[model samples]
Target: MAEQRRRLDPAARRLEIIETAERLLARDGETVRVEDVVAAAGAAKGTFYHYFPTWDDLLDALRTRTFEHFDARYQLPTEVDGPIDWMRVLDELAAAFVGFTLGQERLHDVLFHSDFARRRPLPADQNATIRLAAVIRAGQEAGVFAGLDPEPTARLLFAVLHETADAVAEGEDCERSLAALQVVLRRALAARPEEGSAQ
Candidate 1:
């Protein structure tokens, strides 16, 4: 067992360190140190360095991992039987965003409010905006939503959800914030009468 443990794959070892760090961060907040991560992961200081060149690099990896996990939880369905209820989808996304943020308040703060997270360039494809954009595009194509550009509309909705999440994190009511967000989204995305007549 000892020898087998010694031969763990490099990628798997790296993941172990990251996961261990996450648990430690949850328990200790930003006070978790590299030594703590190495001890919890059963890795040497050198081993941690092998995967993460610096402390910031590890934090960045954690932020990306957390964001990806958050995004995966709120994905809109790809296939539907008929005209998609874009409003319902937006509500679901808003609720999920609020739920995740409130549930993981400490981790969310570390990942989203940290300086590293702010400085990181969030690629459109890797973030929630892209998924929302796809749904908006589908709604537009199906004539169920306004004919605004999907990317910008998606970004606007994403910004609203992001701010709502932040508010919920800061002790605001989740349901109220989510309802407000849904209201804004419904109004903005609703197809205008003139637009329907034009179509």
Candidate 2:
């Protein structure tokens, strides 16, 4: 008699499909096909279509998962007893961004730099840049960062980090790029001398 295969619940099964695709993506990049994913996942073609109606749908889901995975690394505490070390927080956030990009270089490129991804923008509120902007606002309140609008500064800083990580992924010197990032971030966000004096 054939052994019975245990069935996974909806959420678990969906996650399994996504996880399988991630592995295939890491191994094969954007060239990975839905057939490859389904085969590796041990699921039927109908199952893959049931979860993701189209290939683009799957890519969209992957982008969301990747963004959330990166965001989870730098979530700030909602409550604090004393003054926050905004600069330290920023450093850690920068590290997380660069580290994730480099560690998942292939996946990152497929999900972010791909033409398909560029056509489908992630929602604003759920994006990683918004979270970084919140940190910038806090830093401004604490007189650690410049008093400029947090949104655009956060956007610029995020771009810098992205480019830096991409350069490193393309075989540039990691240490030097990181050091340059630190300098750029500090200089760009640091409180002006006048602002410090006023405080």
Considering every candidate listed, which one attains the maximal TM-score? 2
For every model shown, what is its TM-score relative to the native structure?
0.79, 0.88
Colliding residue pairs in candidate 2: none
Off by over 4 Å in 1: 1-9, 27-29, 80-82, 196-199
lDDT for position 62 in model 1 = 84
lDDT of 1: 0.79
Poorly placed runs, candidate 2 (over 4 Å): 1-6, 195-199
- Residues 1-199, model 1: lDDT tens digits: 5577569999889999999988877666777889999987778899999899998899888878877887677666665576567778767877887777667646666666676667775566666788788888877776778988888888888888889988877788877888888899888888887874745
